[model samples]
Target chain A: QKEVEQDPGPLSVPEGAIVSLNCTYSNSAFQYFMWYRQYSRKGPELLMYTYSSGNKEDGRFTAQVDKSSKYISLFIRDSQPSDSATYLCACKINTGTASKLTFGTGTRLQVTL
Target chain B: SAVISQKPSRDICQRGTSLTIQCQVDSQVTMMFWYRQQPGQSLTLIATANQGSEATYESGFVIDKFPISRPNLTFSTLTVSNMSPEDSSIYLCSVDGGSDTQYFGPGTRLTVL
Candidate 1:
């Protein structure tokens, strides 16, 4: 099984709607969880990052992690057209050196007007 | 966040040819990473480049295929050797931001025809 699993969603939603993107990981050693946003033909940008099994809120975006279940989520409030992008969930273990990240398949979100 | 830039933002190359993507960061960093994002797929780590050391590649990646050069802390290059259609993907470079975060470059989109 892949280390991280996410729905490859082209989820369409209306503006002002709430969007929830999630991923499940299989590695218990993963100590950090991150969410990245990628636009068309662009690189992935770090959106939210969480270290513990709790919710971390930054403005309109919230990242939640459940270490027990190895589940992570990113919630976007008042979604806008500009929020249309692919959301990727990444997990990382604390290797002594520079650690590599394990990414999910990414869920594509399109917020329409 | 570290400002990162990549050269040859987009390119088309023939099969069996090679393309080297350059990554430059605004500040000196300890760890640099190379990743590949194929169409409709998630980002997969290719290797980790550390200055003054041989690059450490992940499983399924080899130095012969994706050779990396980290001559300095602020710059790195990844060459896709003997490219094929399967090598057609967006290559991205990322820096390790303290506190378990990573900042990504704009990415080089390569199409092997």
Candidate 2:
């Protein structure tokens, strides 16, 4: 089984709607969770990051992690057309000299007017 | 967040040829990573580059197919050798930004024809 699993969603939503993206991992050693946004033909940009199991809010984006369940989520409030992109969930160990990131198949989100 | 840039943002190369993508960071970092993202797939790590040593590649990736160079803390390069259509993908370089975060460069989109 893959260490991380995410729904490859081409989820479509109208403007002003709420969006939820999620991922699950089997690695218990993962302590840092992150979400990234990538537009077409662009690189992945770090969107939200949380340490261990907890919730973190940044602007309209909120990230939640449940270590007990090995699951994480990103919530977007009042989604806009500009929010349309691929969202990737990534996890890694918190401490290491050379830490590597494990990524999940991204969820494609489209917010229409 | 560290600012990262990549050269030859998009390129079309003939099969059996080679292409080298360069990555430059705004600040020095201890470790750098190379990743490949094929169409509709998750980002897969190719290798980890540590300055002053040979790159450590992940399984299914090899030194001959994807040779990496980390001459210094702020710069690295990944060369896709003897390219094939299967090698066509977006190549990205990332720097560890401390605290479980990684900053990515604008990816190099490669197309093998």
Candidate 3:
């Protein structure tokens, strides 16, 4: 099984709505979690990062991690049309050296007016 | 966050040909990596590029097919050799941002026909 699993969602929502994206993992060794936003034809940009299990809020985006369940989530509040993009969740087993990221199959979100 | 840039943002190459994608970072970093994202799939790590050493590739990825170069701390390159239609994918270069965080560049979209 893949280390990380996420719904390949082409989820459509209207503007000003709340968008929720999630992912699950099987690796209990994973200690670092992150959320990335990718636009069409562009690479992913880091949006939120969390260590271990906790909730982190940045602007309108909130990232939550539950290590016990190996589940993570990202919530976008008051979504806008420009917020439409692919959201990826990545996990890493925090080693001293460069930690390789294991990513999920990204959820595609479209916020329409 | 480290600013990363990639050359030849998008390319259409013929099967059996090769394409080299360059990645440059705004600042020096010791940890750099290469990844591949196939259509509708998660990002898969290709290799880890460490300056002054040969790149370490992940499982299923080989140096012969995707040779990587890390000449210095701030620059790296990934070359897809003898490309085929199955090799068509988005290639990304990322640098570790400490604490398990990575910053990705504007990916190189490759289409091999």
Candidate 4:
């Protein structure tokens, strides 16, 4: 099984709606969770990251992690057309070195007017 | 956050040909990573490059196929040797940001025809 699993969603929503993207993992050693936004033909941009199993808020986005359940979530409030993109969730373990990240199949979100 | 740039933002190469993608960071960093993002798939780590040391590749990746050079802390290069249609993917480089975060560079999109 893949260490991280996310829905490959082409989820479409209206502007000003609330969007929630999620991912699940099976690795208990994962110590950090991150959310990345990737536009077409562009690189993944780190939106937010959280180490503890709680919610971290930045602007209109919120990242939540539940270590016990191995679940991660990103919530976007008042989604806009400019917010249309693929969202990727990544998990990492503290390996005392440059640790690699395990990424999930991104969820593609489109916010329409 | 580190500002990263990649050379040859997009390329079209013939099968069996090789292409080297260069990654440059605004500041010096300790760890640099190479990843492959296939169509509609998640990102898979190719290798980790550390200055003054041999690159450590992940499972299913080999130095002969994706050789990496880390001549300095701010620059690295990854060469895809003898490319094939299956090798067509977006190649990205990332830097290890302290506190378990990573910053990715604008990816190099390669199409092997």
Which candidate ranks first by DockQ, i.e. highest? 3
DockQ of 4: 0.88
Stretches of candidate 3 exceeding 4 Å from the true structure:
none
Estimate the overall C-alpha local distance difference test score of candidate 2: 0.93
Question: What ranges in model 4 sit over 4 Å off?
Answer: none
DockQ of each: 0.81, 0.82, 0.89, 0.88
> In what order do the candidates fall by DockQ, top score first?
3, 4, 2, 1
Error of 1 at A101 (Å): 0.7
Tell me the fnat of candidate 2. 0.79
Model 3 has a DockQ score of 0.89
lDDT per residue as tens, model 2, A6-108: 9998999999999999999999999889999999888999998888578899999999999999999999999999999999999987666777889999999
- Candidate 2, CAPRI quality class derived from DockQ: high
In candidate 3, list every pair of residues with a backbone clash.
Answer: none
Report residue B64 deviation for candidate 3 (angstroms).
Answer: 1.1
Of candidate 2 chain A, the 10-residue stretch with the lowest lDDT total is A92-101
> What ranking emerges by TM-score with the best candidate at the front?
4, 1, 3, 2
RMSD of 2: 1.0
Candidate 1, position A63, lDDT: 98
TM-score of each: 0.98, 0.97, 0.97, 0.98
